[model samples]
Target: MRIKFLSIIASFFMVSFVITSCLDNDNEVNYSPDATIRAFELDTIGYGVNYKFTIDQVSRLIYNVDSLPVNADTIINSILIKTLTTASGIVTMKDQNDQDSIVNINDSIDLTKYVNATEKNNFLVLKVWAPNMEVQNEYKVNIRMHTMVPDSLSWGDKPIAENPAGITAQKQKLVTLGDNILLFTQNSDKVYSTTIPAGSPSDRLNYGQSWDSKNADLPEGADVTSIIRFADKLYLLTENKKIYNSNDGLTWTEDNVLTPDGATVTNLITSFSNSDGSNHKNVNGIASVIEKDNKKYFSFAEQKETGWNITTSTEVVPAEFPTNNLSADVYATESGTLNAIVVGNTQGLDSKKDTATVVWASEDGKAWIPMEIPSNNNCPKLVDPSIIHYNDAFYICGKETKDDAKGFQKFYTSPTLLVWKGVDRMFMLPGILPPVKLEGGVIQYPYSEFSFKGKEANYTMVVDRNHYIWMVGGQGIDKIWRGRVNKLGFLIQ
Candidate 1:
């Protein structure tokens, strides 16, 4: 078919008088052949067989010369030279193996059918149609063009003649953050960080063997829940519902952070050692942690036969208390209650970890007591907490959820450094909740970490200087899930 198409175009000029005259009057017409005349003429075919090719519905804008005359083709082989360059971005012969990402726009969209012998001389258009991408401002589309003759092809990237190319090339964006914030992502088993000064380009560093997916046992469906850097260690929470620990931000050692049962062997959730740098105990499901008065405290969600439970522990196991002393004051009365907790580092009257007024203390790991405060609705039940020592107060930050059927993350702050009961009124933070949506006759809500309904989970936020928040394991209907802030960040949006 291609051969037949070129033969017709070649014959069009066979009868033209200019060709015969140029040959006979070579001595008389000594001037060089006009470039414009040759450019407009169907003369040079790039040293190949003059196969017949049919060009259908050629648009007017794609002509070789400004004033080139258009000849009607009632099944003519020659196509009007659209651009000065003969390389028609339109691909003709595609390798069946060609998987050029450009050609893989929509699953149902067949790019093979778009391949053809000729185009009106224009690059193909690509459109994205995935349901998740339909409304997103940032999306990707794949496209592929076929170039048959190797020498005639003048493309930077061209597919082989009969085989299809791989089209799974995914697109990624380079994000820039302000000076105070450093951004990074975990690609496979390695951790990569790009630090951007307030207004400058990023300085990137890649740490090998820093993070592993097997550490957290990340849920079966999604990649990972969350990762953050706290203290000095590079911690990673995996989808496998486990926590991975690292010291130098390179090599890692993982331990069972959380078991399906409530038993734990470590007292330290995350520790910023004075000598060893940042590190976390090989424990899982702890959400957030913070330090104040040189002491560290951690809060996490654990599974129980009754329902989900939230508990807190200090980094050091006191000589008096050999076991991890969990505060007994706060407990969800019924099952199916989701809770998260984190210590706040902010400075205030009630912000000291050791000297705070009302402390939820337990001398022995067996007994629990909430001293100096009473439980009331004024105290918001926290689900996931981010505790930090900011300013002079030990701030306890957490996701305060509504007590009704659905659970959500509501940012709240408390200045009281004491136990859960003595804390000050819960004040909501400004501008942080995920947007909600109504789809498929159901109200779909956005969760920063776990989704009980959709069973989808994603973790955000950086854990200290190197670690990130990592959340793992959540059944579609709110079963077992353990999440913690780790050292590694994520790239998937």
Candidate 2:
């Protein structure tokens, strides 16, 4: 009878112990703070749905807690937010709307109200916390005044009929005449003009069936070197040292007064009053650089009441500009109130020894002044730099070589043509593909001439009114490509 009593007592004690353990387990709380506030989960109210917000619209910043553990009781109090302007190194703190006060989970903060008006592209740092003032997590948000990214090169339909000879006909010159884009072919004596249609995609070049070809008044087998627009007329300079002008791109009139005698007109540049009337005091004239009898001459033609008053300047003679050969590759453009010219000789052909690339600038293109090379350490020796004045700045694009191998193309921009800043290489367009190696290891692209020189020396780029960059035929390649520059100066696809 005593043994039975002891057994009952042991059973009762076992039940009591199990009940106490259950109560302890149920009452346990996880205070480890493993909850995360993901950046992607942050909600943006107003403006657009994307994480990127524009400064023009009012935006609300909030965090969603749906992804957190359901049984984890996480509490969020206040968010410490700060903004950093990208263009300018300016920092601002979030002070509006009692943002420093305590806030609950899913509470919102007005972001646009705290952002300064001078802030352009910016980044936001949001430090979230729990009710006990313990930091929860931090997130970064990108804000911009403009959301459009740069575009990549978008090739259009062949402006000309493909040559039956299987050779890609070279497009020697590309110029924007008013609202039309004029193209001059090296192998054909015709000029093709097209207009970009409105509402076209970034990768689409609107080469509508409205292509117009005019008989470029040139001798048979002569190639066009440069094309420019001055005084509401389009001018074409050819290899035969001739100048032709047309009020409309269809008709042509030879301007013999501006022609150089026995010299090839290698480059032509013109500056005019800005259409927006921002630069009304600037001169409206045309300038051409020609190589004659082993001499380089700067020819300036000032716009007159009726026609052009031509003047010739011999300041850039061969004695002063000692290029290897008289036929140096010259590129010219008008930047603000200055006319800048870039001259470089072909490597291994015209330049037997290493030569420094030269740049010259002039207000009237008569009294030329040499520009100092940029003092930046990263500024490499530019082989053949292409200069263009687009989007209120002068851009020089070229390639730098290291250990005899061509590096990716680089771009430098200057606001006043005096100081240059090397932009990031990401702003450069896609480079040409590597050429097939010949028996002697000579590199040549398909359908290209058997030569060692790369296409960097022969590229022609032009910027339209819309800031769309149009690349003409490069060395040994007749295909065309174009891309657009965004406000942030990035080149995007």
Top TM-score prediction, candidate number: 2
Measured against the true structure, the TM-scores of the candidates, in listed sequence, are 0.26, 0.52
lDDT (tens digit, per residue) of candidate 1 on 165-283:
11112111111122222222233332223332222111122221122222222222222223333334444444443555554444555645432234332332322122222213212
Model 2, 1-493: lDDT tens per residue? 0011223434554576578668896664333332233223324322322232323212423322212111111211122222222211111223343233222223444344223222544444544443222334443443222233233222222322221212343535666777787776566757777776554343334453445666755544344445566647877755555677777665677777665556666556444433423343455566766667776787777777687776777666433342322111122234334344544444343443333344556556555565665454223456545676655566666556656647334566676665776664325443422337889888774422321124443545666655577655444444455554543232121
lDDT of each: 0.28, 0.47
The candidate 2 region of ten consecutive residues with least summed lDDT is: 68-77
Error of 1 at 472 (Å): 15
Residue 7 error for model 1, in Å? 99
